[model samples]
Target: MAVFEGTFAGDVSNLKIAIVIGRFNDLVTDKLISGCQDCLKRHGINIEPNNGQVDYVWVPGSYEIAMVARQLALTGGYNAIICLGAVIRGQTPHFDYVSSEAAKGVAAASFQTGVPVIFGVLTVDTMQQALERAGIKSNLGWNYALNALEMASLMQQIQNTSSSPSAANLPPGNETIALPKVTT
Candidate 1:
């Protein structure tokens, strides 16, 4: 019998990530973005797009994040995509519609593209609540960023491991080849 499992190393220095930010609530979204960047940097991952390590995309609102994320994922330009936004419940039912769609869409993008699409969007009852999560009290963006990195790394590790057969099953010089690297 054989069992396979992955460990959470969380080392993301060698991976690429994307942050899809919504501009509707720029005040809160900006803070979330900052927290995410700081977290990634502390984890030894650079957020400099010029270095081909991280990329950032701005959209009108939460409702628009998934399409852009899907596009980025399809292009194979990122190992993981983090969607950041703040959806504060309003007087109307607009909040419910938008928030649910955003979550559903982002999830769909992940499923359709086979890429890790991290949902960092915040759906809160008030502006204060959104601020609290963004940075005031608990910085969830930091956690989301870390999660994306961990998931991407783990997935890659699993793919690498499964490509090779056990030592006893090898025949001649034929060896397993690793998956192709994603191109920008």
Candidate 2:
């Protein structure tokens, strides 16, 4: 049996990445971006905005992250995309709709584009909890970046392997599945 896996120890310096951030909760999202940048930099990825291997895109809110992410993914320029946002629960049901849509949209973008889109949005019960996760205790943005790295590498491996004659011996499965394109 053959196996393929992605690790953080690979050379990601050449991989282009994009981070789409939601400015709705800058307090938490900003820290998340910091943590994410730290991880990518540690892994040898240049995090300079617009002039390096990574680009940062700011959206009005989490609700808009998906649209922008999908657009970027469609461009076929980025090896992976990381999304950062914070949606704290409020007294009203507004939290539910926004969080759910953001999650779904991020997933849809990845599925449609066959690109790695990391959903780093935080859906916390309170500001304290969001802060704690953002940096107070640990930052999930670091995790999100790590995920993007791993997925990007894995996808690359799969693409390369799939084209080889060895992949033809694998079990039979549908290889022509199509995903719907994202519309306005």
Query: Against the true structure, whose lDDT is highest?
Result: 2
Model 2 residue pairs with clashes: none
lDDT per residue (tens digit) for residues 1-184 in model 1: 3445433355556688999999999999999998999988887887787887988899999999999999998887787899999999999999999999999999999888778899999999999999999999988889889888777876676566656567337677845444334554
Q: Please report the candidate that would top TM-score against the real structure.
A: 2
- What is the alpha-carbon lDDT for the whole of candidate 2? 0.89
- The clash numbers for all candidates, in the given order, read 0, 0
Tens digit per residue, CA lDDT, model 2, 126-167: 999999999999999999999999988887777776677766
Segments of candidate 2 deviating more than 4 angstroms = 169-184
Using Cα atoms with residue i matched to residue i, what is each candidate's TM-score against the true structure?
A: 0.86, 0.92
